[model samples]
Target chain A: MKIAIKLAYRNLLGAGLRTWLNVVVLSFTFVVIIWMKGIMVGWDYQAKTDTSNWQIGGGQYWHQQYDPFDPFTFSESHAQIPETFNENIANGDLEPSLIVAGNIYPQGRMQSIAIIGINPKQNVLLLPTQKLDTFINAIPAIIGLSTAKNLKLKKGDFTTIRWRDSKGMFDASEICIVDLFSCNVPAVEAGKIYIPLAVLQKMTGMENEATILTFRKNKMDQQKVDDWVLKTNEDLTKSIDEMIKTKTFGQSVFYGILLLLSMLAIYDTQVLSIFRRQKEIGTYIALGYTRTQVIGLFTVEGAMYSILAALVSAVYGIPFLMWQAKVGWTLPVDASEFGMAMAQTLYPVYSALLVISTVLFVVLITTVVSYWPSRKIGKMNPTEALRGKIQ
Target chain B: MENHSIIQIQNLTKIFPMGKSDFTALNNVTLAFQQGEFAGLIGPSGSGKTTLLNIIGSLDTPTKGTVEILGHSIGNLSAKQAANLRKEKLGFIFQSYNLLAVHTVYENVEFPLLLLKLNATLRKKMILEALEWVGLTDKVDSKPPQLSGGECQRVAIARAMVKKPVMVLADEPTANLDAANSHHILQTMLKLNQELKTTFLFATHDEKVINYLKRRIYLIDGKIDKDILVDH
Candidate 1:
């Protein structure tokens, strides 16, 4: 078997220029898929971690009132939180929530910012164990650096929360920024002012009500969570219901376009790779190689190219993606409405499984595409092939 | 079934289809060549001479009639069986010296021997002897493209005989060569025929090739026009 391979490989190497061109094309395609996938995955992770878009507790929950005339109510009929939710929560399988509220602050110019309410003890425990000061034990709130700069409030300085009540009544209250901290989320970078959730609820006059729940662990089945959230919001006010539906559709459409474009790039590269090897292939078949051998030979060759390309992509793609995950890639000012809705800065997520799957899928597609031309070469009449002929 | 005859053909016909019409390339041709005989197939272009030689060489199947070579009927053999038969019993030297361009002279001579599953030591010995017989022993590592026309044809002849097949088919073997180169190839082929007792079959339009044959068969329009056994 090795000897046979050695022979085939030698013949493959005879056309050095063609082989190199194939490798480059394959590698380029591989890089494109990986890079694009990294961007998409990055955007998704950033969106999920935004603390506003996706709820933090593995997932989110919402409730609706029974009628439009009724005041906003959290009713079980609107959405049912699985009974297993608390069990998973207590067992550390669920992530702790970071309650976040958004409002506009006016200085010389008006700037929008987010206020995150954190229980220092619970927040520290839920986050990845790190050396940051415990927020629960400290009285002063920890605000993100960017958020502090934007609001012109620093550590030991006082800021105020202002908002319209449910009756359209205006209200305002002064709060103090105790510390400055930053998280991986880009949205948090610009607009976060962390304080005690209890304090914010009182100041906003919501008493014991929580605005949102956030978590690091995404243990909830995405489909189940999405369905429950949608069902719960179905009976909400028309405006609120429309908001959720529009958000979901908008994200899906953006992601779909990204996937379609990546596939087209991969396909184009593979076609070019195969087209360049026509003469080399005819030579192999003329050497008494069966069609099966020819197919196997080229398929393996195509796979090698994909693997090389994927490896190159992954080496740079994974780390680059991870770095972007830690920080983020910000979109331009002229961004689409959907991009604006996602985050100012988009971070990429790294999944080993997704990378592996991408590599395998690219290889499979390349092999499949290479087969048509390879089989055409394989089935060529030996006489014509031996005559140094190709069409 | 003469003791000396290595191949015999009887009433062989080959029909080829060309663009909605059928043409008979070889029609009702019959002849025989003995072992060690240096014979030539002489005809004009498309006289069915190459077609008859291809059938005898086991490279093509006859549309009708039987071709008996080395006591096996060519018609009854499977494709694989015919390929094996060609490998073992027949050798071919084409006009263009159809040597695989990528392989060296020695590797080309050793090719048919590889198909026989011979050990490397014996294969090397036989290949060296075949190359030596053609006076190409010093050019072992050179590829076909580097060789002169005569040397290339010599390598082709060496390849055909390295397996020690019973008969060799020469399809216009000197067609691509100059006068000196053509004479050198013909003489080398004749020397191998004499020394190895291998039968030689030639399909050629060259009068020079006809002059060297002990017997000549003239073909015209897919029919055997004449067969003259010249007194050698």
Candidate 2:
């Protein structure tokens, strides 16, 4: 087996031009796949983590509907806070909570902002290596880095905020800036502020109002988490059937076309490479190798190409994604609300699990693409092969 | 054919279907060579000499009839089984020498032994002995591209014989060489045949190759036209 593999390697290496060309294309594809994967993975991690931090925990969460007309009135009837919520929090058995309210003003000049309220002490239990105390002090306010920068609100400065209450009432007040924070997920990090739950209740004039109660588990099990999400989605659809019209079929169509184009590029690379090596493949068969061996060899060759490409792509791609996570990709100022919402997006956080999964997926795609052409070797007749003939 | 016959072909036929017509590459051919015999298969371009050689080498399956090599029927062998037989009992030397360009002369010669699953020390010994027989020991480290046409052919021969196969199938082995190189290659092959008693079967249209063979079979249009034995 080793000898056969070594010969295959040498043969591929011998045809330097074809091998390098294949490697270049494969590497390019690998980089593209890895980059897209890393970005996607980064986005996904950022989304999940931010969702957990701001509102959604891995499995279940809650979102509130704020009245746009009256911004300061408290209406307990419109809010959904289970009676056991306070008991769960006091017992320290409840999932984390991410209380978010839009149109928050952290300065005298009003701007569209996000306000997140959390139990500072309990927040550390959900996130690793994070000290929620850094964002709290005697004055106590945790604001997004972008929001603080834009508002010119330093940690020791005083800031005022205004938002609509549950009863469609508007209210305004001053709070002390405590600390600044940022997340890789752009949507949550910018234009947002974090406050203690007690302080948020005082500011909003609601004694027990929360935008969402996020659950944080000790372990991250994907299947269980997804199941919980599915259950929640099912509940949401059952309760709010009219909201189903908001589902974006156009987005699915767009992504489907994009994915098809990417796959086509990969397919073309494999087809061109296999076509060029038809003669050499014939040569291997002539040398007394079985048709199975021929297919195995070519498939292995394609795999090798993919593995090499993956390595190079990984080397560069992982770091780039990390950098994006560390320093978010910024968008221009003066953008629309939607544009601003997406402008300074950071890469999803990096995970070893995600990277390994990406590589395996790319390898599988490469093997499948190469196999289509390599199967032709199984039909080759050795007599014709030995005569330097092509089928 | 006797039990000791190294190769036996009984009523072998190969018909290639071309569109609506059928082309017979090898038609009802029956032939055999004994152990240690030097045989020649002479034919024109499409006379099925290579097809017969391929069957004898266990590289291809016959369309009809049975081929037995070293007491085993070719039809009974699996693909891997046939590969093993070729690695153990049959050697091949193509017209182009087919020396893998990246490999040195020694490595090229060691190619066949590597397939035999031999240990490193035994493989080295066999390769060295084969290279020495072909007078390529001095150029063991030279790659195929670094060697002349004659040297490349010698390396191919060394690769073939390194496994000490029972028989060798040479398809126009000297066709790529000039007259002098061709003569030298034949002399080397003849010397190896006499010393080791390894059977040799040549398939060629070249008269230069036929003159060097002790026994020759003339094939025309996939049929044997003449079988001649020369005075050794």
Candidate 3:
């Protein structure tokens, strides 16, 4: 095997430009695959981190009647603050949010929105709830940038909000938009408003009541708390995992195409080598190599392309990937528009496992492709091969 | 097998499938080559000289009878065994001087020794000596394409003789060369044969090659027409 490798290296190097061309193409494959995969992995990491920071803080406990997916459930998804969380809430480790279905009239356009009432002093979420701490305001509210844009609302704008109390009595009040903050998570941004928890409880005649409670720490010992259901960080991030899995499957098609292009080059080279180097094959046999050994030599020769390509990719790809990780790759379109947790600029994350697996994948593929064509050597008549005759 | 004979052939036949019919290349031929004999299978084109050489070189097997080289029967040997036999004891030179084109003269000559798994120090020493024998010590770094036809053939000769094989098969080794290059290569082989006591076999109709042979076996229509021993 060592001798085969040595000869294969010499032969490939001596082939000059032809060998380098294949190596360059294969190297391109190596870099592109790693870079693309890195971007997806980075996107996954960033999206989950941002979601945890801006939206689902370590975990959530939702009212049993609450279903974020079902807006109708918002009317009944409310309960008095549980006594078990009172201590944690006092310590600022747990935050309760009262959610109610509401409509905002901004610039004479009515938009249905989810009015979330959070503690203004809460630091568990990245949302700018501190802006709701203002006094002398008719119901101070904070809306995400997307919500503000959709309703043509801005900071210090006055808007009328209408909602139902616990007795099913409709009431309307003029609210002041104190801030329009930016958030990467679209679910937290689109058609959502934040106001002080005391103000919403007082207005709804349900003081000390909350629809959901978010914790700062990930662990929740109680799986069920009275009428509340625990939603762990894993459960909150399950959608992103599913999204990445689907995206990865789609990306695999591109990976296959890229690998196919590179493998085709190797297969073509192997076929041409077999056709053109029949004399060399015969010479190998004449010099004491079995037909199988010659095939192995050819396979090794082909696999060496991947090794060379890896080295070549390291030369340029490492710097490029590092730069990308530092500066990030900004998408041309708005990523938040996808209606999921996404940043406009995503930094690629490359792991050691990813790089090693990619290298092994390409090398294995190249060897198989090379061996596929080199199998013709086994059928060659060495005497005719020694004459340089095509078979 | 005769103790003095390096090759023993008894009623050997080789046939190839030509379309739907079988075309016989060698027919009921019997011959033997003694150790250290510089001999040639002198014949015209299609006279089975190369066919016989191919069989003796273990590149092909006989369809009938047996051909034994250095105690191993060609027809009975497995592919690996035949390869081992060639690797350890046999060397072959081609009509087109089939030197690896991408390799330098030194690398081409060092090829067989590499197969033998010799250490680098001994391989280099033997490679240099073989190159010296072929008067190609100066062209060690020149690739086959960079060298002249005569230089390439000399490299092929060096490659064949580098391991000091028990037998060296030359199939029209001078066919691609001019008279000057042909004689130079043959003289080198003659000197190696006399000095190393290595058996040399040739398959050629070229008068230059036949003239240098101490024993000549003439073939016609796939059978030996004459076997003559000449005192040189």
How many steric overlaps are in each model, in order?
7, 13, 0
**Best to worst by TM-score, what's the order?**
3, 2, 1
Expressed as tens digits, the lDDT of each residue in B90-155 for candidate 2 is 788889877767767877777667666789999889888998888888998888889999999998
lDDT of 3 by residue, A1-391 (tens): 9999999999999999999999999999999999999999999999999999988899999999999988899999999999988888998989999999989898778878899999999999999999899885599999998888888888999989999999989999999999989989998878888999999999999999999999996544545788998899999999999999899899989989999999999999999999999988999998899999999999999999999999999999999999999999999998868887889999999999999999999999999999999999999999888877875
- Using lDDT, give the best candidate's number: 3
Candidate achieving the largest TM-score: 3
Encode model 2's per-residue lDDT on A71-90: one tens digit a residue: 23213212435564556566
Q: In candidate 2 chain B, what residue range of length 10 has the lowest lDDT sum?
A: B107-116
What lDDT is obtained when candidate 1 is compared to the true structure? 0.62
**A79-124 per-residue lDDT for model 1 (tens digits):** 2234545665455453322233335443434554455444444532
What is candidate 2's local distance difference test score? 0.66
The reply for model 3, stretches above 4 Å from the true place, is A218-223
lDDT of 2 at B211: 91
Worst 10 residues of 3 chain A by lDDT: A217-226
CAPRI docking class of candidate 1: acceptable
CA displacement after TM-score superposition, residue B177 of candidate 3 (Å): 1.2
Interface RMSD of 1: 4.6
User: What is candidate 1's lDDT per residue for B32-128, written digit by digit as tens?
Assistant: 7787888888999989997787778665678999899888888887656766677677787877777766678987787677667688999999999
Please report, as a residue range, the 10-residue window in candidate 1 chain A with the lowest summed lDDT.
A68-77
